[model samples]
Target: AQSVTQLDSHVSVSEGTPVLLRCNYSSSYSPSLFWYVQHPNKGLQLLLKYTSAATLVKGINGFEAEFKKSETSFHLTKPSAHMSDAAEYFCVVSDPGGGYNKLIFGAGTRLAVHP
Candidate 1:
């Protein structure tokens, strides 16, 4: 089975509003979870990650996510949204089972922050 799945392909939020992006994952071993954001024609930046160390992870630009092992979910959330937050978000997973880190990327979720 695919290791990572992003529940939404697109999400829209008004400026100064909250934003949420859903993701789920399945891994054989303890995995590292990451949320990456990409601006238009730009490289991706890591927003946050859960490495079996913390359940609640904080990230830059007022973003955060909680790792729920029981639910097998990691969802990104922001209390207030900004226009600059409009971009494509990816949920990534890294499994260290094979002695090497194998990164798996979700299809992607495009977030639109409106004015």
Candidate 2:
């Protein structure tokens, strides 16, 4: 079983400020980690992925996350926040042991960018 916990349900930031969203995970097997961003009423777009390959993964829209096995964490970070960056971010985990290759999504962190 693989699971993810998003530390913040909501994050607010001023435009041009740094953005950070925290996440933690637990998996039975070596799992794939992913961060997905969704715009208003839109589908999820893959920001980055950690497939037992890279410890530090970079994603689109100037977002990145580091997979820390010891801390059991995969926290997303961005140098600057844009108005467009205001959206929902989901922390996901893929279980290799599970045959279906389903991704479990966190409740989601809603990012609000203030002008």
Candidate 3:
């Protein structure tokens, strides 16, 4: 079984400050990891993904994550925080054995950007 755990349920940051969202995963095989953001009244958007192509993966909107096999971590980071970045972020893991579409979603971490 593959699963993901969001370390923080809520993260707060001031505008223009650095942001960090931690995630840990457990899988029997080499798994794919992803970060998805869901804004209020909006659909979930793919922030980034790690599929063995690279350890460091960059995504849209100044977001990026590094896959660390030893640490079993895929933490999301940003240089600066923006008000627009506030949303519910979900750390996801793919269930390769089940199917490509089979995914395990974390509870979610709500990001709050204070002015």
Higher-scoring candidate on TM-score, 1 or 3: 3
* For model 3, the run of ten residues with the poorest summed lDDT: 94-103
Question: Considering TM-score, which of the candidate structures 2 and 3 is the better prediction for this target?
Answer: 3
Clashes of each: 0, 0, 0
Give the winner by lDDT: 2 or 3: 3
Cα displacement (angstroms), candidate 1, residue 33, comes to 0.3
Candidate 1 lDDT over residue span 2-102, tens digit each: 39999999999899998989999998777799999999999989999898887999999999999998999999999999999999999999977557787
lDDT of 2 by residue, 1-115 (tens): 7899999999999999999999999998777999999999999999999999989999998999999988999999999999999999999998766477888999999999999
- Give candidate 3 misplaced runs (Cα > 4 Å): 99-101
Best by lDDT: 3
Query: For each candidate, C-alpha RMSD in Å?
Result: 1.1, 1.0, 1.0
Candidate 3 residue lDDT tens string, 58-114: 999999999999999999999999999999999999888855558899999999999
Clashing pairs in model 1, backbone N/Cα/C closer than 3 A: none
